[model samples]
Target chain A: MAKRLMPLLNRVLVEKIVPPAKTHAGILLPETSNKLDSGKVLAVGPGLRDKTGNHIPVAVKEGDTVLLPEYGGTTVKLGEKEYHLYRDEDIMGTLHD
Target chain B: MAKRLMPLLNRVLVEKIVPPAKTHAGILLPETSNKLDSGKVLAVGPGLRDKTGNHIPVAVKEGDTVLLPEYGGTTVKLGEKEYHLYRDEDIMGTLHD
Candidate 1:
């Protein structure tokens, strides 16, 4: 799948991580539900371009766990796999250990 | 509606601006559809926290048109209206004149 879409400048291709069937607060969420916040980095794009037209580096790398804004990103379905393409700015922050 | 949600910090209460039923490329979109990239700022939060814990100011004010990431933000249904509550980081950039 990574071979197919080349994420444009500063955009990252993310594969959302389905949270455990329950929340930290011990609430059971159904599979057909939406959390509004969840995902993991699948592939990251070259960072945004600086004024000099040079590529700035991205903070998060592939395999990093990250938080996404609930309602922002371009959704693309490759074959049967669903992925989201979004800019680095759309990422809130890296999840802490 | 603004009275209900305080928007926490650096978050904005966005009221999505439906595209004009058409795209710049002359594509018509339906109302029940989701664009993954459309919205107007209804109310803005104070701003992100500075190192000193002071409120950093937001770039865009209320009523400004902005682009939202497609799959980020917490969705809240207040009364009959649907609104997205997201952090300042979720906002991509302000629309230009």
Candidate 2:
């Protein structure tokens, strides 16, 4: 499981949320639309230290859903699943529910 | 100047440093190699707030030479020059020079 992948220094490990299967006029929609800009937090990095050497924790936690940019992030492939590693600040925002 | 491009929320504006020109056997090399992995900080965003609402400042400062990843970051084009905006945590490390 990519959940074992621990990000270092204010990074977050996320698994992109898969969009629900959809059909248009009884025909399946293109797979391209399956890519979503949201994900579930899998793992988080030890927060990075500030100039004063104080540790600043990430805003989001494991199990939290977050908004991801269309680009950026380090891709991690574990078995058949894909995960992404993003700096804490790379996450645009967190989604409730 | 991209220096005027202000980044928000723990983002940084960086001007990529041009690699030293190299010539081999008097043949000018391709410009592709000029794309460097390092840059100088031009501007910085107000630090992001932690879960507790405390602001965490970025580690580096303007004029600081920083290491940048080959991928990621938002590209901003100003005139004929190209700049990149990266989150504070996206900066890999600081280079002393």
DockQ of each: 0.03, 0.03
The fraction of correct interface contacts reproduced by each prediction comes to 0.00, 0.00
Show where candidate 1 strays beyond 4 Å: A1-3, A23-35, B1-97
lDDT score, candidate 2, position A80 = 80
Candidate 2, A5-32: lDDT as tens digits = 7788888999987654554456564565
- Candidate 1 lDDT at B59 equals 70
Over the full model, what C-alpha lDDT does candidate 2 score relative to the true structure? 0.73
The alpha-carbon deviation from the true structure for residue B80 of candidate 1, after best TM-score superposition, in angstroms, is 27
Candidate number of the best lDDT: 2
Best by DockQ: 1
lDDT of each prediction vs. the true structure? Answer: 0.68, 0.73
Give lDDT tens digits, candidate 1, residues B1-97. 1125444346677887666777788887677675566678877655554444444777778888888887777675443467776576777887877
Give candidate 2's error at residue A20 in angstroms: 2.0
